[model samples]
Target: MARPRKPLLSRARIVAAAAALVDAEGLEAVSTRRLAAGLGVSGPSLYNHFRTKDEILEAVADAVSAQVDLSMFDESDARDWRTALHDWALSYRAALTDHPNIVPVLARGPGRRPAGLRVADAVFGAMVRAGWPPAQATYIGALMRYFITGSALGSFARGFVDDETAYDPADYPHLGQAHLLAERREKVDEGAFETGLRALLDGLALQYAAVVPDAHAAAGTER
Candidate 1:
């Protein structure tokens, strides 16, 4: 088959197609030959832009980062880092929900992706400016990553199929409502995330208070 139009074979187009494949299938499906076949371009053409499949995967990971919202810091009151972190964590999970296959690769850290680095810089910068110690601010970023990536990897809400007769009330008396609860797992997941986010921020505030008591003093007015 003839090569695809040269314009269609640019780095962005290639990365987009590769990412789409991973989004549809799993990450294992993104080999160079497969990616090129999907794009209607010769495999060699892909080499002109990327040296290897890992390079393409890196770009794909960065593409996923591009969709995350950083507006928590951009538009919110800068002093309200607790609220900002909560919003940012929500946005992080939302973005990963759309491109979940990329989560493993993204969990590997920013590597050399410019967009990924910018995300780290933005979050860390926001927390530090809000009076968190430098080491604590970095830990906070890592702490969010630990939970966010783990959340992306699996769904707590994805319980067994709902069946009224699955749980015998005689054997497990307290689990009688399990059937009904499982059906509303989406709400359960959202509520759990919100509850955990509030608690995490509340705990972090104590650390911030110890180091920056005055900052908390002023922020208490907003509470």
Candidate 2:
């Protein structure tokens, strides 16, 4: 019998399968045995590509990181750091939002993941090139990651049940309309992200001015 043209398993296929599993059933649902069954192969077959489940999960997380758009960091575009950072944060949050289950692993930092490292490198390098000190640039990278991942961890609006009685006026006087939040989850969550992003960028702009005295004038011109 001739062998199959397409191999039954490969590293990319395993990572994709693992990512799908994580997306559908959360990270805990992924195991070598589980992935093997899903891929129609024996459990041992996965070891040929990944040494352990953790390695597979790392690949999946890095794959999610690869989805983030880093184009805004292109120096040739000449975009102010504030604008670039804002756009990058939005893109990062979007990638994490789509794979909320993997945020936990990602929150642990880039580790040795190639794509994850690229994200960190881009943010740090962009900040430095934009006139931010190296130490502060590092802090900026960490800060953005924390904020974006925290935002993706869960939905604030969805936390409130749709039941109007969930927020009793007697117990929660200020949350009179809290019950309506869940129905407008998309709008509320997106608005919250934008509001937070703007606030972050505004604060950073002040810091940038202090570090680079001409930052205000340059920012005004960019605007």
Model 2 ranges off by over 4 Å = 1-6, 215-217, 220-223
Candidate with maximal lDDT: 2
Cα displacement (Å) at residue 32, model 2: 0.7
Please state the error at residue 165 of candidate 1 in Å.
Answer: 3.2
lDDT of residue 49 for candidate 2: 89
Most accurate candidate by TM-score: 2
Question: Taking the tens digit of each residue's C-alpha lDDT, what string does model 1 give over 1-223?
Answer: 9875556678999998988999999899889999888888788999999999999999999988888888777645563887778878889899998898999999999999998898899999887888788998899999998888787886675675588898898998998777876678778877888788778877777777777887754462233
What is candidate 2's CA lDDT for residue 56? 94
Model 1 clash number = 0
Among residues 3 or more apart in sequence or in different chains, the pairs in candidate 1 whose N, CA or C atoms overlap within 3 Å are none
Off by over 4 Å in 1: 1-6, 74-79, 217-223
